[model samples]
Target: MKVNRFQVNVILGIANGIISALQTLWFIPYIKSFLGNEAYGYVSVINGLVNTLMIISVSVGVMSTRFIVVNLEQGNKKKASHYYSTEFFSLLIIGLLISILGIILSFNLRKVMNISSGYYNDVQILFLMTLFSFLIQLISAPFSASFYVKNSLFITYLIFICDYLSRIMMTIFLFSNGEKVIWSSALATDLVYLGMILIYYIYTRKNLPELILSKSLFKIKYLWDVMRSGLWVGISYAGNVMLSSLTTYFSNIFCGVIITGIYSAIMQLNIIENTVLSVLISSILPKMFKLYSNDDNQSLYNYVIDSMILTTLFIGLISSGIVVYGSDFMSLWMGKEFVKYRLLIVLTVIYLPFTLPSQVINQVFTVKNKVAIPAIATLLFGMLNVFLIIIFTKWLNLGIYGIAISAVIVQVLRDNIFYPLYLKNIINRVKWKLSIPFLIGVVYMALGISICFLVKKVIVPNTILSFSLSVIVSGILLFLLALTLYRKKEHLGG
Candidate 1:
């Protein structure tokens, strides 16, 4: 009855995929029907603003997974407890700082986002709700991280499903009857995180007693160490958020909130691509930590390569399918108004194939604790992306497509060109190991592009039917190709 890491990850991945797809299908179209694009745009703006505020908490969670697994693997129970205790207090303080900032921002948010006076109170309540939600997540970072250390992703996914289901149902009910969509959605989300905290607390008390904090919880050295280790990751996390947040903010300031809503919807569709890559990389991450801790470089190298190739191929298949049918698909999913942004979808997906592989490689950096390089790289490139988004959208008048163009250019430079060179210098025998995956990716992408071209030429009439066929067909073909190739070159998975 017990599940291995891969099995759990696949189950979680499929479960999340279904949930996310349903969410995208139900929430956006239903809300847009009544709430209108402008209201949805404001919602997106608030979400981005709050996400930018949560960067430090995200960094702490990432570091918690690393340190918790490291200390636990070493059989140092006290050290593991210290790691948990350190991040626990540190994030609580950060959450307090966020609360003060959130309060101030709530007053200025209407003017800053250029909202009308009618929705001011609604926006304020949503902002405050998001702030509370984020604060709870911050304090509960260690408990959540403990779940990942135990490979309890199924629990995470279960909570995520419940969260989305509740949020979607509430959104439908409220939006249908002319209630505030923003408030309902934000409240549902905050409630889910609170529920996650409660469940994790119960689980820890029952099964993970050693994770409880002790008298050493306030040790200055331990707190300093966790902060020091997580600093670059925090910067890196902030940098990553800056990339997308800057786009949304710049688009809102220059192009208007309507465009922001449309762009956000396009990005939500692309999240399906991200979910696949995330599932694969996250599935192998705990194992990577253990392998690196044992100094099993060969196994670790193999894992990184196989995961990158698999992710690259699968993302390529899905993204390429999107490139072929996204215009009709979005129009059918949302409304005919969304069809105009097909080029935006194309440009957004161009980065998926490349970004997914880079994420896998970034996991290598995290496990080796060589995070500074990628962290610095992400910050520098993020700034570059922001600069380019401003230039293209503001000056050149490229409109919404400008944001997508800027993101792809920066992603190619950072992930494809720079990261490989950085990894070669540090890890031994990585170049040869990376070569196979790299070559395979090149071949698979070429085939994917050709398949996309063929599929695009097909004269399908009904948008929904066409979209369904494209996904089902492409998925089957991609899986079979992977199975055939893996069988022929077994060493690829070694």
Candidate 2:
């Protein structure tokens, strides 16, 4: 039983995701406990602003991966190098400019964010450290792109695990010594980014030697080419950031800092689920891109359908657990105070089945270089999400729940309705009947939620150990059920 690259990548990715989630689990509570919820809230708002500004670098990174992989698949190493070099130099310039912008923003953070007079200087320091970390990541994006080119996400995940560990260790060291400031987290993050960038650079130079940085290889035309393909990716990423990060800013504005802190804490569960999902999906993307580039539409279609089912099942399992055990887990992890926000946790993730499976389809748009429409839809819906949040929170006085509800509505509209139809239109050669899998996904979610709730009723898990046991039992039962359903489908198809 020899393991393949994909299997290795998936295993490493899962491990990395778990580590990252644990880091979040520890980091969030530590910050809230030592620095207070207001400090944690300020840190979250600052980090959100940085993420919102990272759209350009993320777009460049994505396009660099796509272009590099596609060109390498075509046996054009020179073209791939050109794309890499162009992006590398471009990001350097972008990083410098953004650093300056971050400085200005840091000085005037009061105007943009709802910061208190007492914590203004501390928040500014946190903002600067976070901005510096982002700058490091921005410049290193091209180097990291090599892993995707080689389908070597195992290496990437390994590095990420190390980074997470370092952050945890640094935070513990800083906080234990009575340096319990919000900026300590950002300082830890900066060190982690510095280490990660060095590792990425060394790995790319040694293993992926074909990707070279040279002034000669950097072309204006190549920059134009990458940007032409990447602009939509940037727009789509902007929408995603708004939906996630900008919501934190809105929370500060509408509900106040204390509530924003609590909302940010609850959203950590959402972050963990997404971190895992993104890692799993990223493991398969190189293969998907390869299939598309080779004109293997039938195989690509099959691959996509399988991915949709698997992604849906995974999210369903996680969502069901959240819906059932969220309060118990939150009580154990954060404190009984957080248990009151259990409904917010449910709202944060309840729409995954409707949206995430469609995300698999949405990737096809990127593969086919047909992202304008989807990107526009995402941006439009993101704006709608903000508008609805304001209306619900202010006018209707729905408060924090308003933000969650708005997200669910917008996601269902854009991802559920638009993405599948758009995918059907673009992948026209394959006559993809998405209804079967879509219906199957619905069934999976319904059963998962119902059975998990039944388990909760049958076995009360008050303590941590009891909760762990309950989760294990329920997870295994769901796994077995999913396996049976998948095998039956395969048999019928056969």
Candidate 3:
């Protein structure tokens, strides 16, 4: 049997997913055990901030992928090279500026995050290390874009898995050796990224020689073109950073570092959902770009529709498991103290209904180059979410659940309800049928909620053996349902 590109991507995605999940599972406990909860919270904050800085790289990367693939489709190797080289140098400059910013910010670590004076040095060291690691990734963004342009994510993911595994082992060694400084873990992470820079450089030279650097590739015109295309992408990323990082910052300032630690644990588990969706997005985006460029409107519509339904069903199933067994899983995985965060965990699932489907829609927006509206909306709503979090926590005394609720509300309104409507107008060929997935998501979530009760009756919630059986059974059933729906919808759409 010959595996298709989509199959290859999915396989790689799953591999990356498992590796990421395992790393999170292993390292969170290791950090908590060795470095303690306060340090864990600081680590989470640092990581969040680093990812926030990634806005610069991601903006350039999205444009690089778009321009490179589109230009290649036109058989314009020079244009692709121009896009690659321009973005590469641009990201280098961005990385340097951020590195300087990181150094300056490192000095103010104690005041910035309210670090206790005793642990001030540790936080500063970790912050600096994280900054360096982020800087490396920033510079490597354009090279990573080469893989995406070629639709060769499997190779990229393969390298990443190796990197992740190496980091895990190194961190474990450091922890066991009493080198419990959080900066050591960050250093281990940077080393992997440095290795990736080298690997991607060699690989791009071998396979995508056209994407290599040249003086002719460094055109001011192409640099401006990239910046123009990437402007909204950068805005969207800034909004996302605000939403996620501000949540951590809020928890730290309002609730305390311990709660931030707890919140981070919840988010780490929640990342499993994002991991799967990210794989799906990466797998489909190159195709999405191609379909749009070819003016294959109907195929693009069907593709978006099918993907929306499939992502909804998949997320609904996982959300079901989380709804039914999240508390138990958290208790077992994190610690018994986490059982109290059950409601917050459940609230996070609300995002799945809106977020998962929107992941597919985002690709459509990107392909159409109409990302400005959605990006601006995200910024506005993200700020709204932050404001709501403040009001609910400080004024209404609602706490972290307030923050989670605000996020879900804003996402549903903006990304879910608003963005799809916007896409219908932009794509012009899309119809009201696109709304079907929303209805499906609602039903799925309801069923998932109902299953929580049915599950409790069938299997003891906290029992390891019983919970495992429930997940397996639910997963199989959900997978079958998703397959049936996908095939049925695809045939009907065709």
Candidate 4:
């Protein structure tokens, strides 16, 4: 039997979430114990710096997906194939160039960032590790974009499993041998990612008929289109990297590395949450591209409304659950020291829903060929985030918590205000069809909060049992409420 979209999304989401939870939340304790807090902070900060550089070298993969999906929707298979082929080669070339450039520039990096002399070696190795990771990722994306269009989420999950499983094994090995933990960790896991990329390419060559190109994909038209589309994409990545990846460099100079570690843990949670949401939304966008291409306005409208409603319900439920239990669970995973500030985690729990609206809104734009909205929103958010961090960090005396709060505020502005405004501007309207999603989200959120409180009061201590029970009970209650509401609406000729 063919898997439905919901089944595919749920399976892949759960699979990846399990690995992420183990790798991120679980590994924190392991790394903190082995490397000590200061060392862990150093590794994480360097990792963040590397990610900032990577946003420049890579990140056009999303724009690649949008372009490829559009061509596929227009039934232009050969052009789509050529596009992916070009993307694969272009990204490899860029990755090699960036890696070489970074190595050459490493000598000046310490002075450029003004880090203490003691931390220079650590920063250099971290930069090299990050560069390698980017190369692996750049190669994976062209093949991975095929999976996105085909809804091969299981393949995506397999990629993540390879990554996290390597992390776990290496954590054990590095801890045992007293090796340089950061470099060992990076070497082990990045090799795993590259191996997975090789596997994905093999599969794509055999399985995906749409990706097979015979002649060189060096035609000027294809090169021009990819470059033009990817220029905006590069700018968008620059903005996102400014907001996120560059934070550690800024924090180290202006704030401190210990606090950056605390912030890093929060970011790990954010990544896991957003990754799940992206998997949920990804399936719909590809399908919606077809509807939009055919000029099926009604179907497009319904898809938009339903996607927002579902995302709101899903993310709101998660946020409430996290708010109630996140601190307790993380306290167990890491330590009380790391968990000292309940307020940051609590603020993060509150912030998840506010930050979630953009996923759907941005997808709406992607399917409709309006990529400029996200680029514009991300650019503005980037500038505003820098200003807020500087203001909150040095002046407010609020410390790390202030940074977290400022980050959340910027996301809320981007997700809740800026994204919708972009959508309305581009689409030139916001129907009740749009507002109904907002209202449905409100209802689900209210119900979810109530359920979260009840679960907190009644939940027991066994991890496996508690997780299973929560999933089951939440499913039943949500299903009944949705069924009743749908029936009532149908009675009124909805």
TM-score of 1: 0.94
lDDT of 3 by residue, 1-494 (tens): 99988889889888998898888788878788876777778888887767777787777778777887778766788888888888888888888888888888888776667576667898888888888877876777767766666778898788778867987888878877877776666777778888888988887788777776866678899988877868888888888877766678778887887888888888876788888888888888878877877888889988888788877877777887787778888898888988888889988876686567777987887787777888888788778888898898899988878888887887778767778788877878767678777777777777766766575677675667777887777677666666666566644442
Evaluated against the true structure, the overall lDDT of model 2 is 0.83
CA lDDT for candidate 1: 0.77
Candidate 2: tens digits of C-alpha lDDT, residues 55-124: 8887777777788878877779899899989998999998988988988888888899898888898898
Clashing pairs in 3: none
Task: Give candidate 2 misplaced runs (Cα > 4 Å).
Answer: 430-432, 491-494
Clash number by candidate, in order: 0, 0, 0, 0
- In candidate 2, which residue pairs clash? none
Per-candidate TM-score against the hidden true structure: 0.94, 0.96, 0.95, 0.87
RMSD of each: 2.2, 1.8, 2.0, 3.5
Question: Which scores higher on TM-score, 1 or 4?
Answer: 1
**CA error at residue 118 for candidate 3, angstroms:** 3.4
User: Model 4, stretches more than 4 Å misplaced?
Assistant: 57-59, 112-123, 458-494
The models' CA-based lDDT, in order, is: 0.77, 0.83, 0.78, 0.69
Error of 1 at 220 (Å): 1.0
Candidate 1 C-alpha lDDT tens digits along 445-487: 6677676566556736375676677667766776676666555
Model 3: what TM-score?
Answer: 0.95
TM-score winner between candidates 2 and 3: 2
Superposed Cα RMSD, model 4: 3.5
- Tens-digit lDDT track of model 4 for 309-344: 666666666666666656666666666664576777
